[model samples]
Target: MRRAPTQKRSRDRVENILKAACELISASGSDTMKMGELAEKAGVSIGSLYQYFPDKASIIHALAERYNEESQHCLDEALADVTTQSGLIAAFDQLIDTYYDLFLAEPVICDIWTGTQADKTLRDMELEVSRANAQSLVRTILRLRDNDGDGATFAARCLLIMYTGEATMRLAISVPASEGREIISSYKRMMGRELSEMLQV
Candidate 1:
């Protein structure tokens, strides 16, 4: 027997609802999103919204998944050939350059990407993405030194913190790209010096 056509329409409507939610979330902060507005933007009924998502958190969770997929693709491409120490450092710098450029290209979307969820479910999803990024970075650091898992992990976390802080700072202060490059270069130099010391120990 064939399934009901209404079922297919229901799924399509859910997808449309989520898409509209993401667009609205990008324009305004996630906290500012309204259900009525989302229904109007998606051309769906509030009842239909309940049929798909229990609350705004579900829609936001879906958006998080969408953001993660896009970010994973970009990061994969950025780190695809980082096999050597120098290549890893170059990739690290290039990753920062590429990521900052991407984020600056869409500040609103970047804000959406940076959005957080208060619930544990949403936090868990983001945590998985964070852990995956840390693991990838740690692997790259390992190529620079062996038998130092603890140091590699520490380096990855430190670099991630530094990179994220610098990106946000540059955005907040509207720092020029040339100056930002210098700042990032200095960070790379410091990281190299730290790694040298770690290796010597």
Candidate 2:
């Protein structure tokens, strides 16, 4: 972004730009979307759009950040009430289902995620976010283990689980709905097994 939106009006303009971009992305794909079209759709001047976001990738990156932030909020909510092993497992199941539904509902997110595969910068951002999320899970697991000594093994396993969960979601959303749902189900089962043993019974 060339300049961060500071005032309320600027922030609203930024939101409008992103909203227009998302609509365009859903209608076509982000690859073919043009800045002029986004500016026109957003009812903002092209200069204003460029002021907030220098290019298409930055706009898409903002969208990715927003989506991830929302997902993180869901994870935080799930974390808040989960103290026991079964609660943790149920939270994981709920989060998986929530994300699956989110991906299904948000076509723009799907397109942006697909673009990340080809963009090294976006891919690295995703990996960094995954590590941060994994640390949250690791901490929760440690609490379950009575705050046992940092649990290096658990830390590594949590990171692997986080990576696998993302991979599973990407794969699950690619197939037909029936098969995609089955794939998610299988992942939930596998994840349950992975998480169950890591915590106290």
* lDDT, each prediction: 0.63, 0.86
* Candidate 2: segments with Cα more than 4 A from true spot: none
Candidate with the greatest lDDT versus the true structure = 2
Relative to the true structure, candidate 1 reaches a TM of: 0.66
Task: For candidate 1, write residues 152-180 as lDDT tens digits.
Answer: 55656645654454345345335677776
Q: Which runs in model 1 stand beyond 4 Å of their true positions? A: 1-11, 113-125, 143-201
Model 2 per-residue lDDT tens digits across residues 100-122: 88888989988878677888888
TM-scores for all candidates? Answer: 0.66, 0.95
Model 1 Cα shift for residue 48 (angstroms): 2.0
Candidate 1 lDDT at 38 equals 92
Give candidates' CA RMSD values in order. Answer: 5.5, 1.3
- Give the per-residue Cα lDDT of candidate 2 at 154: 82
Error of 1 at 37 (Å): 1.5
